[model samples]
Target: MEPIKISGILSIILGLIFIIFPVFSSGVVSIIIGISLFFFGITLILAGFTASNIIIGILAIIFGLLFTFNIDAVSFLLGFQFYIIGIILLLAGIIGLISDTQISKIASVLIIIMGIISFALGGFSIGNPLYAAILIGVCLIIQGIGMLLD
Candidate 1:
């Protein structure tokens, strides 16, 4: 098999593992995000004088503190971001549907489906981070399979 195919196969296999054991992945991801946020926040706070926007630096520090100290809040914040993205996608899909183009319609439907999935995942993430992780894992698995086929 070609290198690309081999890479795809490996991606699929890794995705499957993530899907099967999502809690571990979620935990690990959460830790990494928390640490990153914490450090970034510190950086912003320390370098506030250099930032073009003072508010941005302050907000970053606040959010960084929140993510570092409050794991549940971090989860909810991430979920909220996803929900916002879904809402944007949903709007785009609606626009595509209104355009009446055949290809656009198909793309719109797929986008709408993705939007709904993202909305649901956001809700699930707020309720249970493990479920959110599972959703992400499933998405990765699907993408890997698509790549393998291509």
Candidate 2:
């Protein structure tokens, strides 16, 4: 079998485990999301030129750091941060629309979708990590499958 096919199978299996696991903790979830946001923010900071992109990157970095280093206060702040990020994303999307590049608009749309999801999920009181795990796992599985197809 090809390596990509093996990777896809592994990703699917891992995703299933994360979806089924009951013992995962919130801290783990926080870290997972935090790291992802941190890197994503960095990528945005480097990729875009608009003010909204910079603001969103800064906000993402702040939230990512908070979740990574201080979980105690994150529960209270998560919802607010997510809302703020969502707004920033919307702003960025609007700004991107004004630009001539279709790639910018496409990326902005994806960011907006992610922001909306984050905003909606910010208030969940239970199984936060499980939710993140499942979402990430699904993404990984999809990516792996794409690689295999490629």
Candidate 3:
């Protein structure tokens, strides 16, 4: 089979896993992110471009270690992730609203609503992780199908 087709199949399978085992999938993702961050921190420190970089690198390493070694920290960090994503979406919506196009205005309103929901969910520490996992799964499935079609 072609590489794209193989990847498409893999994406679909991963998406199914995400949907079936949302909690496990999220935990795995968190660990992977933590490991990546730990390595990234090491790289930054070794590069030693500037004092600020070193500071940021140290901070990253600390957080990375926490995320890697502590499940509680991972859960906390997941909530924090929602907050970060919410802020980014809110900012994007605001920027989109600044545009003069009609579509932009409509999309911005939706984005703003989603941002508010994400922010509230983060603050409440509710079922956002489960919902996020399911949402991601659906998206991945759609993307995989698209890739196969292409």
Q: For candidate 2, write residues 48-143 as lDDT tens digits.
A: 666766777787787888767756856775435446556656665666667653346678688678767766755443334345556656766687
Best-performing candidate as measured by lDDT:
3
Clashing pairs in 1: none
Candidate 2 runs further than 4 Å off: 22-26, 48-50, 77-88, 99-103, 117-150
- Which runs of model 3 end up more than 4 angstroms from their true locations? 71-74, 82-127
For model 3, residues 32-146, the per-residue Cα lDDT tens digits are: 6567567756765675455544665676677667666756735557756556546545755665577443335887789789879777756653446676677668878988998
- lDDT of the structure predicted as candidate 2: 0.64
What is the descending TM-score order? 2, 3, 1
Q: Which has the higher TM-score value, candidate number 1 or candidate number 2? A: 2
Query: What clash pairs does model 2 have?
Result: none
TM-score of each model, paired residue for residue: 0.49, 0.63, 0.63
Q: Residue 71 of candidate 2: its Cα lDDT?
A: 63
Clashes of each: 0, 0, 0
Better of 1 and 3 by lDDT: 3
